[model samples]
Target chain A: MQPQTAPSPQFSLRPPMEAREKFNRLTTWVIVAALLIWSWRGSEMNPMTLFRDAGNIGTLLGDFFPPNFMDWRLYVKEMLVTLQVAIWGTVLAVICAVPLGILSAENMVPWYINQPVRRLMDAARAINEMVFAMLFVVAVGLGPFAGVLALWVHTTGTLAKLFSEAVEAIEVSPVEGVRSTGASYVEEVVYGVLPQVFPLWISYSLYRFEANVRSATVVGMVGAGGIGMVLWELIRSFDFQRTCAVMAIIVLVVTLFDLISQKLRKMVI
Target chain B: MIHVTNLNKSFSGVKALSDINLHIERGEMVALIGSSGSGKSTLMRHICGLTAGDRESGQIMVNGCLIQEQGRINRDIRELRTHIGVIFQQFNLVGRLSVARNVCLGALSRTPFLKGLFGNFAKEDLELTCKALERVGIADKAWQRTSTLSGGQQQRAAIARALVQRAEVMLADEPIASLDPESARVVMSTLQELNRTDGITVVVTLHQVDYAIQYCPRTVALKKGHIVYDGPTANLTRAMLKTLYGSESDDLFGRKEEAPTIVQGAAA
Candidate 1:
């Protein structure tokens, strides 16, 4: 390294490192403090409420204890129905979403085609699954089919977005290598594009399937059919014991599906 | 079997190639030599119809079919590409695919459309793919994932893919630029073997002048979008290089005669 020159009479040759470090630290702290203050005000929160409301939480926890197992078979049957809803919904979503996923990717289509398809997916995702379940329940009347439709629409939007990202991130030369062989557009997608994205596509689908199972249980509360119907009814009648029982069943089933999906993903990936 | 007349290209209103004219007979191994940003790649892209030359000043013909004229690619260029192969310096294979499967992709154009989609290749395609792999000396690697292969092995697989395509003309854009000297020698020998034995026309771009003189008898040199030299490679002597590249000639041809010739490497 060059030896440091004598300090210039007018100004120093190099910056003051200590002052720069202090300034950077101050700026970071200021930003974090601003964010904390803004969120506290926006939520209308009081820090003292944590201590004041401690007893209310304890009372709720007390009511949740000593869970009842009466009609365990009925709860299991309803849990199976919720699982069925997720399965049928994911099946339909996979069918619809894979094609839309390819179409939505700008690398696969011209912007003219990709733009409208992406907008449609964005619109589908704008509304929450609960709201979609309510609308479908109104349309189809109260049933598991309504829950299926809700999960199908929501998962289709999410999975297609992920699939498009995976497709876009593939190496370009492999596609060009296929094109050099005089491949048509469809052939390019099958041979060049699909192989690169297949593992990621499978991973995304499995993840979506897991998420849909959890969502399926909640949609039943909106009159879309599942164990949430029983849970909601018990809560309304102040049958906290039965509500706890259904909640436990939901947790067990969701965990089971998560484990299955994880295993399948591991085997394939 | 390729002819280019008055080819010109510009990117964002800046000229990349101008007023280029050339012709290559069948089964000629010609080298396009140049410094960086000297229009070698641009010329190769234009020949393959991957990029269009300047409007109203260009025409290219390969195997008697018009690839492009007046900077517009012919609709039939898609069909024409079935007879021409192109290779790049990097990312030449789909890493997730098997070597055999990547070779199989080269036959997709001629296969029935549905067969290509469903991957139900004909018996002829399989036989040809095997033959191609064997020719490239990588038949043992047919079942391996492409990413597992070394750089030389992957490039050989790419060459096998081209052989499966049955391309009459091969345009390689700096195929050995990213390779070591030994691997570069192997690739050059493969191209040389294909040119000599199968009579496939090979046009390759090179930054190393010694490789060009050692492998290709004909040389075309470009400097800043202009054809500075086009003649026999034997005539590209120190005096000629000095005139074409001036002080930078040393950088282009600086490497000594340590690398073996294509024939010497092929025999090994």
Candidate 2:
């Protein structure tokens, strides 16, 4: 009788694989190494440098503690102004962004409308908010109004892109079903697309609002009227104590904004 | 009454429906039976004015209205759709919405925009929706999220939406294809009851000849975008099925028959 033999294992019969994959892996490693070297060259990212600078960081932290509550009245007023700027800027951005978001959505708008609106949004977003503030300060002559306008334009662009994507990802069946029922295009969008994405839109808008609080303070550094302007002046005079106080106030305000926004996001989404 | 003459539709240079002619009368349940890609769904879509074709190539008249003529479709096709209901295989329920809301959508075209925005459905509309839910035997589930329902229940909810639309003609595209045999029978019986009791015109596309014979009085068969047979359901013979579906006829209809009660139990 013939000797019993084991059956061969089944294997894929495709080619041994492409050299491109190996080349790609090597190229990725090379790019990563080059990026690390390039970043290290100018940043002085050595551990020794960090250790040597640790003392100065500690000194700064020590100065920040027992924060100067001496100008409590002035600080509270400035903090209120900063809060107002953020709130108004975000509200304005939301008003402007919603319509733009609808117009920019490829699924909602026709190509003729969407393409132009997207390009317009791209151009609007390309300019930094600080730059817009500087331009508006020059035109409107320095105030929270300029700062609010700057934040409005930048946030509108960002939120429009995000909200359009949200709109685009909605299930198409309900929209089609609604349209099939003799409903107008506007009605279909209102009923089918809006309900599905409204929660996500609210969540994203609240997230942007949190970011805008930080951005609003920074824009005030360019003489747009907030606590940042006072902090900038204190830093310019090298009054580290008062600067630390302003910084503390800013952190407290931003942290509060973050907590509120998080709560609202949870409720909405 | 609806009339379709010499209907032809093409997609991306491929013919999906060609030289098709059909006439559907009031209160008749016609089943369009065909294999996959045989253009049965496409034909049903055209009848409801969801898909448009060259008007010069064909004429479609619904209730004395010339809906399509000379490569042009009527602008009032939406109004035409109000008189017809469409049921999809997937049951197309918005997952997050309640069953009542899904049915309420059927009345939205008639309700003012502001009313719809606040979900201020008219009392009569609400009553009709509830009645529709009752008719489909899912009234107790009307307030529940549609996604919570079983496949059979979801399909019934879809039927309720169609009923609430007060549609005179119902077009079901492979309604039972996705259901188990028991659920399939339930849905088919529902359609049959609608046709027989309410005098609604029902045109449903089906894959199995057995269901078509059991539920529909008339049958239309298509193969490769062409109508191969159109006659009474009782006339569908093994030879005709063999001719239409080729050697796959046995594979299509032949099966180890299960007890109908077992199918019902599975559905429940």
Candidate 3:
């Protein structure tokens, strides 16, 4: 008691720390560094090579300066086919996905019903549309049909997953309100669940349709038959000028499609 | 009209209700009074077959039909639901749907299921709904989206749905817990009108003791999942309330200027 104790000082700008927290932070950084090294080696990533080859990319780009228009009609036809593929794929996805979406929504059904369906959807989503398109091209013998099938499978999985989440996030109180009316399970879903999630489902489907349009354009490179085949051919033949024209057309078409669909979606919502 | 005997309920092994034995005659208006987590809501839920009680603990019956026995709900509870209306504190309406459609949902069970999905509500049902909306004084907002309506209006719309359901017994779980004083008065008055005029049995859980006395003739006080008091609302003396609740009894009431010991415990 003879020695007077000092009161704690006021707060300062410098951060106060615990040694344990500092050690944890260092360990995290070490783990992150190790993982980065492992991934770089595994993927064979070399930034130096990309930097060195940057001039060749410029040279390759320069070759496409003046685009050729001789193949305009063929490009337009292929482009339209891509659009049709997108539309068909989206329609199929909507019809199939809506049911699967409802089935997979955990809140809608019990674990036994939704769990297996969700796992099956996971398997569908794990494969890219490009991979599916490649398989479909072999099976269907190379046409827009193959592209459409690939987009349909992939988009169904995606939209179903999205729609299920929207279903899960819906206000449970209204569903309870519906249940108190003695509405059957199907009736509850139709009146209570579907009405709440419908707008969100529509918006998600519209967004997925736009992505499928882009996918349809490129799936043709794997012999799934769309504008991608023409673009792929020009690239392979070193007809860079015509490739530029196709790229320009793809840009214009995708933008227009996106704009129109967005407008429609806005109106519906 | 309602019978609950030897009821016990627990969630995750924690007791929410315990040994509740209550009987209410048809056309009686009762108020359930308690602080938070006092099992008033649990009792109401049990009556409507929304939640099940402990196995081998109790049975609940409505109009001589067993709702649940030994924690098992009867499979034919759907038919029973047509006669009971449950209103929540949140005013559980499908917000995106029109107010009229939300009300029309009460008429769904009466209509064929397939036709209900297609929204083939009958002309008579629509007229009934309009009459219900009129009863709630929201006929002008019938076709408007329910979400657009204010909280008090939405609660009225919910009551209208109950009227449309032709529910004999109404269970309101803190119907005006979120509303302002003026709105709360309107909502309580509407429930009062239903009880006095239509002779509908209304069991309302209330937070404010003043409203319990002002509106409901009878109040059942619950504490720790057990009924501490069940008698005329006028008999809820300050000392009784203090015994029922502790220091927290102060917040359970509003407008304390009136004498609490004035026992107007007249039996109706």
Model 2 ranges off by over 4 Å: A1-17, A31-65, A139-141, B54-56, B254-268
- Model 1 C-alpha RMSD vs. true structure (Å) is 5.9
Scored by lDDT, the top model is 3
TM-scores across all candidates?
0.91, 0.88, 0.92
Cα deviation of A269, candidate 3, in Å: 5.7
State the weakest 10-residue window (summed lDDT) of model 3 chain B.
B259-268
Stretches of model 3 off by over 4 angstroms after superposition: A1-15, A47-58, A262-269, B256-268
Q: What is the lDDT of candidate 2?
A: 0.84
Worst 10 residues of 3 chain A by lDDT: A1-10
The window of 10 residues in a row where model 1 chain A has the poorest summed lDDT is A1-10
lDDT by residue (B161-208, candidate 2, tens digit) is: 888788888889889888888888889999999999999999999877
Model 2 docking category: acceptable
lDDT of 1 by residue, B95-190 (tens): 998999999888988999998899889999999999999998999999999999988888889999889999999999999988888988999999
